[model samples]
Target: MRIFVWLFRAFIFFALFAFALNNSQEATVRWFFGHEWRAPMVIIVLLAFGCGAALGVLAMVPAWWKHRRVAQRGGDIAPAVSDAPTPTEVQTPSGVRDGL
Candidate 1:
């Protein structure tokens, strides 16, 4: 399984490499104040993808911090669940029938 995963990753890497090579044309990015930046199309796309990934990680920072804090305090990180309750042991609230 690990070998297959590695092979898959290598295949994807080569595919992306070939795509980048084929799309080496210069592309322009216009900014405010009539400014423009130019770079290879592949480079621009890769940069945008990287920036988006970074931003996505940044967006999760607060949730990660909350989890870290809970873990540091040794609080209940998981919701309550006992091993496995038998049908008879599981309780049903009033006005609800167990259909026994």
Candidate 2:
């Protein structure tokens, strides 16, 4: 399994390496005020992907904090029904029970 994972990683690395080598041409990014920035196409693509991912994570920060706060406070969401296991219920080793 480990060897397969390493092989997959190597394949990905070489593919990306080939892409970088093929796209070494300069790319231009023009800003709002006619400002232009130039860099390799691979770098531009990588930076764009990195910034988008970072922004996505940043956007989720508030929701994550809210969930954390609720969890720490024992989410008293809808009151537990008379029969079902509540969120704090202890379970078996597998943490699952067969319905049948």
For candidate 2, the lDDT comes to: 0.91
Task: Provide the overall lDDT of each model, using Cα atoms, as 2-decimal numbers.
Answer: 0.95, 0.91
Give the clashing residue pairs of candidate 1, or none: none
Give the root-mean-square deviation of each candidate in angstroms: 4.6, 9.9
Model 2: per-residue lDDT, tens digit, 23-95? 9999999999899999999999999899999999999999889888888998854557789678779566676
After best superposition, candidate 2 residue 9: deviation in angstroms?
Answer: 1.4
Residue 3 lDDT (model 2): 100
TM-score of 2: 0.68
Candidate closest to the true structure, highest TM-score: 1
True lDDT of residue 90, candidate 1: 81
